[model samples]
Target: MESPGRYRYRPANTLYAASHDWFSPYLSRPVRELLDAGPHARSLLRSPRNVDVCILFTDIRGFTDLSRTIGSDRLFRTVDACIGRQIRIIEHYDGYVDNFTGDGLMAVFEGPDMTDSACRCALEVVSRALPAVRYGEAALAPIGAGLHRGDVAMGTLGCESRLTHTAIGDTVNRAARLTGFARGRDVVISERIRRGLSAETAARFAPVQADRRRTDIDAIAPIYRSRCG
Candidate 1:
C-alpha cells in the first residue's frame, strides 16, 4: 500500500489508464464496464445495428418568413420543438434521427425491416407535424419530405471535435436533394424507394425522378398522401 514509483491495476478497484480516463470506481457497474472498454464503448452502447437502405429528410416550408415574424429567439424555440417531436417519432418507429440540418431533419432506418419502418415513420411524422402547424406551434413554414432507398455505408465518423454519427454515400445526399425539391406538404419518393414500399405505400407517390439526373426544374414528379392513420 506504500509503494512508490509504481502503479497497480485491480480490475475491481483500479481501472487501466488505457481506458481513455473514463473508467472510475465512482461510476455504476454498467457505466464502468462501458468506460473500461474505451474506444469501443460506442459500439457496446449502440442502440441499433447498421443497415444499408434509405434515408429520409424533411424541411419546414415557409420558415424564412416565419423566422422574420417571430425573431430568432422564438423562432429557435419553435424549430427545437419541431425537430424534437420529429426525433421522437423517428425513434418510436425504431429508426434513428441522424442529424438536424437547420430547418430540416435527416433520419435513417436500418435492418431487414428498414424500408417499411422508414416509410411509416416518415409518413407518420409528417402527419403529426400538421397539428403543430395549426397551433402555429412550430412557426413552421411548410414541410417537404423525401425518401430514397439504395446501398449506402452507414457508421460513426471522426474523432473528438469532428465526431459525427451518420450515414454516407450518394443515396444520402440524393435523399436530401430530393427532399429539397418537394413543395409544401408533399413527400417526394425516389424511384428505387418507391419500389421498396408496399403497393399501398407505393400507390401514395408519383414519379419524381426517372433518373437521379438534375434537371433545370429538377423535374421531380409529384406524390400525394393523406395523413397517415
Candidate 2:
C-alpha cells in the first residue's frame, strides 16, 4: 500500500517509461494530448496559458491537533483514506488531482463550466470524504476548501532530471489563500467564481468579507461561503 499522505498519479494502463513521472495519470485526456505532441510541448509547462479553470484546495481542519491525538499509524491511515476518496470524487466531477498538500490536496477543473463543476466537487468532498472515515472515536467532520476560477499559467517546473507539472499565477495563489478563511465544513469561493455561476447556483452561497489586508490580491472584492448540507 502507498504510504500515508503521499499522493502520486497512477494511470490505468502500464506505465510508460518516458513520461512516467512527468505526467499525472489523472490528467484529463485533453491535457494528455497536449503533452504527447512532442518535445516542444514541454515548453508549455513553463509558459503560462490563459485558460479557464477552477482551482480547488481542500485541507483538513485542525490537522495538527488531530495528528498529535491520533498515533502516526492511525493518522496516516486516516489521511490516506480521506485523500484517496477525495481523488475519486474529483475524477467523478471531471477534475484531476494536481498535488497533495500534507493532509489536504489540490485539484483542477477545466471545461466550459469549470467553476460550477469545482463547486459541486468541493461540496461532494465535504459530504462524502469527511464522513467516509473515522479514527477511533473521532470522525473527519470538517474539511475546508477554497475555489476560484480564472486564467492560470499551467506548466512544469524542474531541472533536466526532474519535472513537476503544476499551475501558478495569481489565480492559483488566490484559491490557495482563500482556504485560510474557510472554517468547519465551509467551501469558500472567490468573486471570479461567483461571476461565472448562474443565478440558481449563485443563490447557494452567502457573501462574507475576507480579510485580505495581508495578501497581494485585491481585498475589496467579497469572498463567498456555503455550508455543506
Candidate 3:
C-alpha cells in the first residue's frame, strides 16, 4: 500500500479561512462564485453562451515511452504530482482546468488579460515543472503546451444525474491540435493567440517554420513557437 503522504494532494490556495474544500483545486474562484450566486445565475449555467477564452493544452513529452519503462502505477503517481503543481499555476492566472487527458491537461483562461496570462502560465509550466519533476534520466518528461484564443460555446452537458460543464468549439479543437506540435518545454500558439498578446509578450514567440506549420491551423492563422527563453 502507498504511504499516506504518497498520494496526499494539498492545494496551494485555501478555499476558506479554516477548512480547505476538496473541490477548490478543480474550480476557479470566479466559477465557484458564479455557481453560488443563487437562482438568478441558472440561465448562465443552463444556456450555452458564446464567450472568448484562451485555451491551453499541455502534455508530457515522451510520456508513452516513459510509461512503458516505468509502468502504469508509477506513471499515475507522476502525472498526479505534475498536475497538482500545474493546477496552482493555472489558478494563479485565473484559469480553470477543463479536464485531464491521460498524460496531458486542458485549461481555459478568460477576462481581459487572458491571452497574456495563458502564455505566461504555459511558459512557467515548461520551465518550472521540468526541474521540479525530474528524476534520474527516465523518470519524468518535460512539458509542452499549446494555446489558442477565440470564441467557444460554454455550457453544461449531460443527463440530470451526471453533467459536465465545459467549453466547446473549433477554438478548443485547434488548441488540442496545436499541442501535437509542441515538444520538450516548448509553448506553441495559434496566430490568434499571438495577435492577442501585448507587443512585449508577442516578442517572445516566433513564427513556426514553414515545414512545421499545419495547413488546417494556418487556414485560421499561422502558428508560433516559444521556449522559456
Candidate 4:
C-alpha cells in the first residue's frame, strides 16, 4: 500500500512558469502595458488611444513569381536577410516595426517629425537594404513602399488568452492600399505626408498621377513618388 506522504503535491509553479514563457517573447513596453492592465484590457479595446503616426508599408515586387522560381530554402534566407536589414534601418531612424506581412512589413513613426523620419527610412530601404540583398545569381527584387500620416486607434485586441497590440483604422488601410500602386523601387506618399515634410524633403519627391480608378481610397488626394540614385 502506498503512503499518502509519498504523493505530496508540488505548488502550481509549473503553470506559472508556462505562462511566463508564453508572454516573455512579447516584452516590449507597449505589450507589457497591455498585459499588466489585467481586466482593464477590455476597456482599452473599446476605447483605443488615438495617435498621429506615419504608417509605412513595403513589399517585394513580383515576389509571387520569384518565389516559384527559387528554392524554398534559398528564398527564405534571402527574404529574412532583406527584412532584417530593412528593419534595422527603420529602427535606426526611430521607427517601430508593427508586423511582418509575408514578403513585406508594416511600421510606424510617431511624434512631430514622424513624416520626415518615415520618408528618410523609406529612402534608406531603397538605397541600402534593397541593394545589399541577393539570391544565388539574381539581385533581390525591387521593393515598393507607401507612406501616409493620420490618426489611428492603437490598443490590444483578441481573446483573453491571446492578445495582440496593434494599430487599426482607415489610415492603416489607406497606407496599405497605396502600396499597391507603387511599382519597382517606388516610394509613394500621400498628400498629407507631403504637406508635413520640410521644404528640402518635399522637393525630393515629384507629384505622380496614381491610377486609383480600381482602388477604394480617395483618388483626389495627390500621390507623390521619390527615386533613389
Residue-pair clashes per prediction, in order, are: 4, 2, 0, 0
User: Please, what are the lDDT tens digits per residue for candidate 3 over residues 1-229?
Assistant: 2112211223223323124467655554434544443453355457777888999999998987888887666677778888888888998987879888888889989888889999988888877765666445656878889899999998778887887778899999989988888878889998888888889888888887634345655544578999454
Candidate 3 Cα misplacement greater than 4 A, ranges: 1-20, 23-31, 39-43, 135-137, 210-216
In order, candidate lDDTs are: 0.65, 0.77, 0.76, 0.78
Clashing residue pairs, backbone N/CA/C < 3 A, model 2: 45-155, 45-156
**What is the C-alpha lDDT profile of model 2 across 68-103, one tens digit per residue?**
787888888999999999999998998888888999
State which candidate has the highest lDDT. Answer: 4
**How well does candidate 4 match the true structure in TM-score terms?**
0.81
> Candidate 2, residue 194: CA error in Å?
1.1
Per-residue alpha-carbon lDDT of candidate 1 for residues 1-229, written as tens digits (9 for 90 to 100): 3212111112323333344465442332233444344465566434333446678999988877777777677777777778878888887877666677798878877667778778878877777864563334434766778888876765456777765545778788778877766777777776667667788776666543344465622455443333332
Scanning candidate 2 in windows of ten residues, the lowest lDDT window is: 1-10
**Model 3: how far is 149 from its true place, Å?**
0.5
| Model 4 CA lDDT for position 15 | 32
Compute each candidate's TM-score over C-alphas.
0.69, 0.81, 0.81, 0.81
Checking candidate 3 for backbone clashes, the offending pairs are none
Tally clashes: model 2.
2
lDDT of 4 by residue, 145-183 (tens): 989999999876778688667889999999998888788
* lDDT accuracy of residue 22 in candidate 1: 50
Ranking of candidates on lDDT, top first: 4, 2, 3, 1
